[model samples]
Target: MSYRRTTDFLLHDWLEVSSLQSRARFADHNRETFDAVLDMCEKLAAEKFAPFNRLADTEEPWFDGEKVHLPAASHAAAKAYAESGMLAAAQDYELGGMQLPCVVEMAANSFFSKAGIGIGGGGMLTSGNANLLMAHGTPLQQQVFAANEFGGRFSGTMCLSEPQAGSSLSDVVTRAVPDGADFEAEPLGPRYRLRGNKMWISNGEHELTENIIHLVLAKIPGPDGKLVPGTRGISLFIVPKKLVGTDGQLTGERNDVALAGLNHKLGYRGIPNTLLNFGEGKFPVRGSAGAIGYLVGKSGEGLRCMFHMMNEARIAVGLGATMLGYAGYEASLAYAKDRPQGRPMGPSGKDATLPQIPIIRHADVKRMLLAQKSYCEGALALELYCARLVDEAHTGAPDDAAQAALLLEMLTPIAKSWPSEWCLEANSLAIQVHGGYGYTRDFPVEQYWRDNRLNMIHEGTHGIQALDLLGRKVVMDGGKGLQLLASRINATIERALALPDFAEQGNTLAATLAQVGAATKAAWATGNPEEALANATPYLQAFGHLVLGWIWLDVALCAQARAATLDHALLQGKLAACRFFFRHELPRVGAWLQVVTRRDDTCRTMDEAWF
Candidate 1:
């Protein structure tokens, strides 16, 4: 099957993206420069990342009871990416970065993801890690670790999940004690010794860089000499793989971070997912009992500091899933167009003498292809919209920034979970489109599906995100965020109404929006938190569908406005996708909203024994 990059949609339908760059004060990056960056990314990914994608999957990382070893091609691809300077593409020039807008950076990164998500993950983690430090790290910490990370001399990881504490960060038992007296004074500030084991750490241990900067979450004891309970006591720390001195040079002494083992997975096997032991006594640290580290921010504010990286990561995960689904869609579309199969339904025997037509001529195949196109492309719009919101929150006018923040907060959970859910469905349909061959490893769709399955669980599970959306975000600040989002969607609906071709879609979305608002109130009317949130997942689904409906209408309006200027086929494709979503996909919102609006409790009220 022929491969394709979905970034084409960004250029054709999302012309407003350039305005975002201008708003962010990216004066040097006009449309030409932006396209140049994307072109370079496509070339690099096709050459360095794509060739090794299947090899990395087949030869997964392994531990030799001493060190972790990955394919040499993995290192070559990572080095190529780092040397390309894309890792710090969004950072300031003073920080040795390209100073591109966040939206442009995300657009460029999507190319790598389409080539391979596992390789793409390393860059995402490093970029997020560097961005966090740049935001909250002390001056010296930023100069040393963050600089190295941005320069690609070092990579980074976020250690949050422990064997004992997966998502329940409140139960984390990692301990950090002041040990500044033992270590010489350094530019990174006060030091401590971190002791605990971190599980499911991606890029935890590798030779991809000179060193790994670990942003660890642990607790520092109070006067009672006992660690405080829950997230309130947690603090962030910078733990490195090898100790560094005040001169920004390696001390030649390995830190107390050891790899306990490797967790082999079904997909995204390019980078090593590890079980890491910190200060486990398997490795000694200057006669110390734990890993030496420096504080990131104030004590008891670890979760707050970590949120900087987590939020960035959440959106990146959504983009990753979107690209994977898109890759599969492209592959399937190519296959459907080229592979001829059974005759059309009119008359089989009469056409036996005639050439067999491609599967794309069949109505069902078109249905599946259209479904894939809508879901994947709609997801692309949602993620790029979120990225633009990030840019607006940082650099827009004061009122615009405030409004952007509110909308971002309200839609972030949807950004993470909606794409994860629907894009995975796109991958499934892509597999089905390939028939028997798609189920086998010989084709890429199976791998795409396996890789996408992890996105639903990464950053946060679907259920966790659902609770966050329905139980917290929708109600925060007297529902100001939801109101802001509603205003934006309403504006789109109003604009779409002006176009005669989209008046019906606008009406459909407007009705869905009203239903969603009604359901939101109905779901929370009981006043009992448990009773009100019993069906949060369905509410999330309904809310997600509504958001997609709004986004598709917005996209159709954009296409309709450019109908005369854009390619005839491209414009038609966008219009067709918008119609498919409204006609076939948006109606499902009504069913989901009915459950939310009525506060359905079929599962909530069921007895445990019924299972």
Candidate 2:
């Protein structure tokens, strides 16, 4: 099957560092490297990753006695990714990677993950590991560990979750005791031993790599004989799969950590999520009954040090969620156009002799298509926007960048969870578009649904996202974060309001902004935030709906404005999508707003015993 997409599908003509301020006469930045990165991704994805998606799912990674056994195709895909220089795209150039823009990387990452999140896991972990190493590891530490030790043969895992502490890291029972081993330890790295277990670790125990570098989060006893509750008491360490010699190669000496069990998951099955016992039988190879841990930043500043990597991972999570939705939308749209189906609803007026039509011809089907298109496309726009913010955050625009970051922080949960929730719904509707046939195993849609279900549970749950939105982000820096977001969207609407067709949409968006602003004030008015937590989820959804609407309008306005210079008619489909969403979807915001303003007894009125 040929998976051909037109350039019309994408918002921009090609990858470029566009002046966000420049509406006309756009120039592509030094995208030679970016184009090379894109070419590498396209080549590897089509030639290797895409073909192995179904195969990987069919032969889901397995745990034998010692190592996790991934299919040969999966391993080959990983190798291809590494060789193509795409595995470490986010790393610094000196770190042996094709340093590319985060936005461009994200665009390519969409293709890779869409091929299979299962196959994409290894590369994701590699990038994450490289990030951790880059941020926390010292110069000598980088030389011995990142450069020489693991080198290309090593893999990394962010071992944070435990049975008792999933999101609540402060509650982790993982302990790191001081070591008096004969082995020479780094001055900058953690010079102790770790004795604890971490659960839900992806790629925890796999033979695909020569060694695994476990970034264990642990708490050592303080002077008062107790580990603190805050992040200060926590520490990060690089516990290797095998002890390395001065030359940076492994000594073939096994570390204390052992794979307890493999976690069977719904999707991303190619990467093994393992339950690990850090110090088990024959443990503490270099230390006394505890696994040796080379410290990261400071003794107690582990959480602070890890934040750099975690924030990067958060963007990755959002990016993953966005693209999976995009993939489903693209696939479903193609199917609608390609698949021949029933005729028009009209009274067979002109020609009853005519054959059946594609599903795109139907108004209701078009509604579903448009819904998916808008949701996924808005999500793409948001992710790219956030990526641009990240670029600015790194470059010259510090204050604006910081404010942009604050806005992203406020919206991150929504970015991650909204796509997971809304786009999974998109996948469901894709199945519906396929009719009963979609539910069957014959099509990929069912698998797509199964795969998408995990996205809600990944990085963090949807409820967690809602809480993140309402509980913390809303009031951060005296609500300046939210105001910053409002200003950005309002600015877009201001530009769009100049257009003829967008005047009504501009008004609708204005109304939504007002509603959201008011609801935010009401949310703040409650005396106790916990008591007011009932309004959290609805507020999240209400605000999410509005953000999406704003972004969609941005896209429509762009298309309208750019039409004169370019083949504006080519943007007909995107314009239709914007109009369809405004006409069909925007009206529902009022009801959602009612839900927000009323703040009803849905969670109230019912007793706990009723459950």
Candidate 3:
């Protein structure tokens, strides 16, 4: 299916996103406006992004002595995406935003991600940074920093991981000190001097925009002149690449921030990933050795503020992974239909005179294609469903909104990690469908696979997400989030139970859900973090499969409802994918859950010298 058709079905038919118009926030938009937005983005992505995807990959960004150089196509793609007005698509009208629903915005952006995720530029990070500032920054900070970022004049990066810290934010040693005695009197916000090195920062240094906003996380020293330990001492600082005045104009003077070096990556090579040095005296401000930064939010609340962007980025990463997988699926499917291969088995004897059939006619080929379909399409549905929940959490009635928020918290890790894992698997299968050609760079599927390999480590690694799911998200708020998720899944189960065609799947899903609940209880019954989280990744995998199963089943119900009017092939295709997932995919949940439920410690308890 075409990207447009898939998005149209998800937005209008399945999710009924147009119903969002009844909400006061989306009152100005109808199906026409939404379609227009999608149409524009689709056209722009095809013209500017798709054609250069390979160019971006082949001609990776390189650094000259003074600046970074990306393919000319990368610059054009970034400009087109910025001019498309999607960076602030869900923001208020006063912010130069379309005020589109979050679901619609997500659907629209999928086109770009599918076309070329790396060349999609820093728009996601920019919007996410602006969103964080709007939520946590002072009014002046929002006007000066967030506004410009939304306007596309400034790009953004979240500087979290350091060379030593990696994912352990508590171990971060980056320090921020008061700029002067009168630092609190600074107009933009409390002023500080930050000195540290940040590693693996994407879009950390680029000339695509007028300025780059670095939201650096560092620790403030205590009264005794020693840095406070753990995350409690951490604080967020708005460290712009260049000094900016309170009026939002560049001061024509560089800040102390400097790009130390770039990391040559395996894929997503179009965007520069850099090691940044802050307050390294590269370009000192006012004769000071430290990088000047403005505090955002209160001290000791940096992680809380940064999570706003981190969570958003996690979902966006999932969408990126999903779209890449989808692109591979479509490419392989097209190849299968056109490439003639060995003939099918016959009852009597081989007929040499018969023409070779399309590879898609082979049972094994269909199995591989079906697996990709079940993965990528279902992942697309899952991401959009989460996007819909974002809308609900933001705009729904009070009680409903609260419920949506709880459900979102529980699903966030799964939403990020599941697609990152399974969609990459889908890409592998797509390459497999292409036979030997798939393994070569001659085909795009290999690049798709390479690009997707990063998603498992992006945002948060699979292990971190697993620990977060089992250790924190499920158990937080007296388990209210998990309970809310269960309620939502069960609601779908109740609906499916009434239909004879879906009853078996519904029962299977119910059993899987029960198993998940049991595993959660069994894993945590001892109240030991080590024991409970020992097999957290397995727990995550099992729980994610259960969630995807629910998503596919729910989507199948929608397809069944439109059976009379929807195309026969499309309806069958949806139902078939759902069936394929339940029969072929969902059963794997049991093996994964076994380790979680039993708290297996084979790997966890292994000796350090075992290797």
Note the Cα lDDT for every prediction shown.
0.87, 0.73, 0.92
Runs with alpha carbons beyond 4 Å of true place in candidate 2:
1-29, 148-151, 181-188, 230-232, 282-284, 348-354, 565-570, 598-605
lDDT of 2 by residue, 287-339 (tens): 45677778887778788877776666766776676666667677777788988
TM-score of every candidate: 0.97, 0.91, 0.99
Output the lDDT of residue 22, model 3: 98
Candidate 1 vs 2: which has more lDDT = 1
What is the lDDT, from 0 to 100, of the residue 11 in candidate 1? 46
Ranking by lDDT: 3, 1, 2
Estimate the Cα RMSD of every predicted model relative to the unseen true structure: 1.9, 3.5, 0.9
TM-score of 3: 0.99
- Using TM-score as the measure, name the better of candidate 1 and candidate 2: 1
Ranking of models by TM-score: 3, 1, 2
lDDT string, candidate 1, 1-611, tens digits? 12223355554356466665555468767777888888899899999988878888888988777778888888889999999999889888887788787888888898899998877689999989988998999888888888889999989999999998899999889999888664436568668898999999999998889899999999998899898988999999999999987666798999999998889897898889998989887778888679988989788999999999999899999989998999899999999999899886664444667788999998899999999999988898888889988888999899999998889888899999998999999999999999999999888999999989999998999999999998999999999988989999999988988878788998999999898899889988887777778888888898998999888888778777777876777778878999999999988888887777778888789999999
Best by TM-score: 3
Q: Model 3 Cα displacement at 510 (Å)?
A: 1.0
| Regions more than 4 Å wrong, model 1 | 1-15, 20-24, 180-186, 347-350
Please say which candidate is ahead in TM-score: 1 or 3.
3
